[model samples]
Target: MSMNVQNCPRCGKLFVKGFAETCPACVKDIEAQYVACADYLRQNRKCDLQELHEETEVPMRQIIRFIREGRISIADSPNLTYPCEVCGNPIREHTMCDSCRQRLVRDVNQMMDEGKNNANAEKDAHHFRITDRLKDRH
Candidate 1:
């Protein structure tokens, strides 16, 4: 597959972007952490962030990041909760909660309405003068 050249957020090295956001070195490290976390989850099934970090030797931040990115979900493990990207509200599924999503929709609609209104106002205020030759036409 074709890959875009992108800077690795973790190491600041440029590489061909693929499935993972980080570079190959960082991806390997992340994969190892994921494996450790998954192995612990297999046995514990439902555990809190602190417990998972202690048991698996994976950082709590990475685990939370995984959840937020949808790499790891809480469908079966309902105990996990990540902050909403917009309002910081705890959510189960996507990045933002229902309220934030609705708010974003409203904000976008309001901006669109403002743009339409501005365009109509400009159209209504437009001025033009007919040339003498045009005015002389019967």
Candidate 2:
């Protein structure tokens, strides 16, 4: 087992880092904030992300993280959205928007196709003929 120690980013306190980035105290605080935010959303289902943050006093980043992590479903809250990881466009559900995702897929497919084409070309070039080298003399 490996033991890890690092300063908590939230509190700047030295702690044994585990699955969470923050220390236990900060994790507890975040849990509290999540609970408060959830409770507020339950009472006011139509509230947007900004209103939720304003009402619960939870940081907008934290709220966005919650949404990204799938802790808070935004099915009823149509206005809730987080920035796409690749393009920074406001989106819900996945890490990237549809256009960015499609572009990534196309790029990956093109790279794979290029790799296959290169392999085929190398295979074709591997064959050598005695006549091919001495074609000018022949």
Candidate 3:
């Protein structure tokens, strides 16, 4: 029931925001490109990004997007790799390498632990000054 108006990234047309990003026309075009890329990959399992882009005529950005979105995978092509978002190491899957992922997990866990400790400390310093006053009066 809620409507949001935003400019489409593909054609720059203002449109009611929907599940998919691009407007209807652009969606069709992107779908066509995805199909073409998928077909090309099926035939050429060992292809790299450059060769895939050259052969399929799909943009490298879109191809990378497909990998990020999990629509495409590079397991069969061992040489294929994408830069990690954190350390820029070459990674075959996900945005980060294993070390970066583990580090992030540890950092987040430490933050959560600190938050819980703070909350517990606050609870213990604790309170009920008004309750004590009422009890004394009674």
Candidate 4:
């Protein structure tokens, strides 16, 4: 018998076995989320499904199903505020799409790198003073 190798759809890891779609890492992550959700419910007694989804990194739909199945309790209060899906930043008025958030993060990181390089060059040139007392000494 011959086994076929396929790349996992989730993590892109190559596997030669059953036709599981996701990679081992992604499977482990899902299991971890299940355990974490269970643990959170047990410890906290009750929590909003949205909050558990955010904290455990689980999907809201899955959490809702878990609640329906008695795996977790649904709080009577309003749903928890989840961060923007893209940048993990708190979303206020407008919904920030994932693509936009990722782009913003990339841009911010690039800007930060540029600023760091500029600061290093300035430091090498002694453009900034560290101590006010040393100004007269130089």
Measured by lDDT, the strongest candidate is 2
lDDT of 2 by residue, 1-138 (tens): 877999999999999988998999999999999999889988888887778989999999999899988889989777777788899888978889999999999999999999999998998799877888889786
Off-target runs (Cα >4 Å) in candidate 1 are: 1-8, 11-24, 127-138
| Candidate 3: tens digits of C-alpha lDDT, residues 12-114 | 9988888988788889888898999888878888777888889989998888888898888787776667678899887888789999999999999999999
Ranking by lDDT: 2, 3, 1, 4
Lowest-scoring 10 consecutive residues by lDDT in candidate 3?
A: 73-82
Which wins on TM-score, candidate 2 or candidate 4?
A: 2
Model 2 TM-score relative to the real fold: 0.80
Deviation of model 2 at 67, angstroms = 1.5
Question: Alpha carbon lDDT of residue 2, candidate 4?
Answer: 72
Count the clashes in each prediction: 0, 0, 0, 0
Better of 1 and 4 by TM-score: 1
How many steric clashes does model 2 contain? Answer: 0
Best of the two (1, 4) by lDDT: 1
Q: Which predicted model would earn the best TM-score?
A: 2
RMSD of each: 5.6, 2.7, 5.6, 13.0
The reply for model 4, stretches above 4 Å from the true place, is 61-138
